[model samples]
Target: MTRRISKTKQFIMMNPIIQFFKFIYLSLKVLVIVAGGHGGTR
Candidate 1:
């Protein structure tokens, strides 16, 4: 029972860490694309 609970906790922790990085990557990608588009005219 304790092992199962620990495994579940670890899985929960890992998912959020993975998601946070993914969100950061996506946001950076969007910012770069936006900057690239505006940079040429200015």
Candidate 2:
């Protein structure tokens, strides 16, 4: 039970950083897709 609690605590601590990186990743992906679509249309 203690180990499970510690794991949950660790996950809670790390979740925000993970979400931040994920947000950046999604933004980059969207930018690339938009650029590709614009270039393709030309």
Give one clash count per candidate, in the order shown: 0, 0
Q: Which clashing pairs does model 2 show?
A: none
lDDT of 2 at 37: 65
lDDT of each: 0.78, 0.79
Candidate 1 residue-wise lDDT at 19: 74
Question: Which portions of model 2 show Cα errors greater than 4 Å?
Answer: 1-14, 39-42
Q: Please, what is the TM-score per model?
A: 0.49, 0.50
lDDT of 1 by residue, 2-41 (tens): 4656867677667978879878998999999988775355
Q: Which residue runs of candidate 1 sit more than 4 Å off their true CA positions?
A: 1-14, 38-42
For residues 9-41, could you state the per-residue lDDT of candidate 2 as single tens digits? 788657988879878988999999988764355
Please name the candidate that would achieve the greatest lDDT relative to the true structure: 2
Among all windows of ten consecutive residues in candidate 2, which has the lowest summed lDDT?
1-10
lDDT of 2 at 41: 50
